[model samples]
Each structure stands twice: as C-alpha cells, then as structure tokens.
Target: MIAVVYSGSHYAHWRLADRGKTVASFRTSGINPYFNDEKQITTLLNKNINLIHHAEQIKRIYFFGPGLASNELKDIIRNAFLTFFKFAKITVAHDIDAVAIASCKNTEGIVCICGSGTNAAWYDGKK
Candidate 1:
C-alpha cells in the first residue's frame, strides 16, 4: 500500500493505493510545520476520518506541503506523521520541490521558489 499527498497553504489532499489501485481518498487542512505545532497538526490530520481508520494499512506515505524549509520543520512534520501512522515509511517534502522534481525529472532546468522565501537553483538533474 502507498499514499501520496500534496498540500498548499489552504488545503491538503490525500490518496491511498493498494497494488496500484486507489482504495481511499481524503482531505485535511494544510499542515505547515512552520505554522502548526504537534497538537494542532495532529488535530488537523484527524479530520480525515479515512486516514485514521486506514493508517496502519498504508506501508508508505509521500507528503508534500508548504513551509518545510528547515530540519526543525521536517522534524515537526515527521513527528506528526509518526503520531498517527505508526507503521508507514513517511517522506515529507516542500511543495515547490515536489512540483519541480515531478515536472523536470532527469532533465536539467532551473528550480525556484519565490514569494516571501525566495530561492533559486540550477539543476544538472542529478542534485
């Protein structure tokens, strides 16, 4: 089983799959490690009743969301995932990097994150 999630500032969407077939879909409020504490993130994640019921069934999870810019933030988000999905292998990433990597793949191009926290990178497609 696997799970994938994408989150922006306002919302997060979750999809769960088994043997490449989608089995469940759910949504929860955006969980930004920069803005939410453990308790708040836990509460928000609980809003998705399906996730709660199927947490243990998921073997892996890929979550992309805003505000995951530091190790502290990653730790915070990881803690939140561990709190609920006790058995899944979880990967949390910044939303922009998720989009960039998905779109570019092994092709070389520029990847940038603008707005309040602006960053730019040149990619050889390896790093």
Candidate 2:
C-alpha cells in the first residue's frame, strides 16, 4: 500500500492506494509546519478519524507541502503522521520537489511549478 499527499497553504490532500488502485482519500487542514503548529496539525488530522483508518493500511507515504522549508519543519510533519500511521515509512519534502518529481521522475529534465506561487528548476531527478 502507498499514500501520496500534496499540500498547499489552504489544504492538504491525501490518497491511499493498493496495487496502483486508489482505495481511499482524505483531506485535512494544510499541515504546513511554517504557519501552523504541531497541535494545530494534529487537530486537523484528529478531526477526521476515518481518514486515519485508511492511513493505517499504507506502508509508504510521500508527503509534499510548500511550507516544508527546513529539516525541523519536515520532522514536525513526519511526527504528525507517525502519531496515526504508526508503521508507515514517511517521506516529507517541499512542494517544489513534488512538482519536479511528478513531472520528470528520476531523469534529468527541467520542471516548473506554478501553484500558489511559481518555481522552475533543472531536476537531476532527486528531491
């Protein structure tokens, strides 16, 4: 099982999949470690316990958010997921990395992201 998430300033969307097919999806407040604290992010996730049920089945999680600008922030988000999806392997990264990976995979190429803001990069396929 796998989980994928994309977060912006306003919302964070997540989807759980099994064998490449989507099984469940949920949304919580944007778990941006920049503006919102761990308590707030926890509140958002707790608000939807049903979502956590699906999260439990996930073995891997790829979380991307615009606010993950530092390792400290990444740790915050990672810890939040750990609170619920206790056994899942979680990977948190900036939204820009999400954009680049989504478009180019592990190949060298140029990628551009135009979400709430704009960014462009030459990705060597790594985030």
lDDT of 2 by residue, 38-92 (tens): 7777778778865657756778989999777689989898988888777799899
TM-score, cand. 1 vs. native: 0.85
lDDT per residue (tens digit) for residues 1-127 in model 1: 8889987766788889999899988777777877789889888777777887888898898988888878888888889888988998989888776667876788888888664456677767655
Question: What TM-score goes with each of the models?
Answer: 0.85, 0.88
In candidate 1, which residue ranges exceed 4 Å CA deviation?
111-121
Clashes of each: 0, 0
Cα error of candidate 1 at position 103, Å: 0.7
- Runs of candidate 2 with Cα error greater than 4 angstroms are none
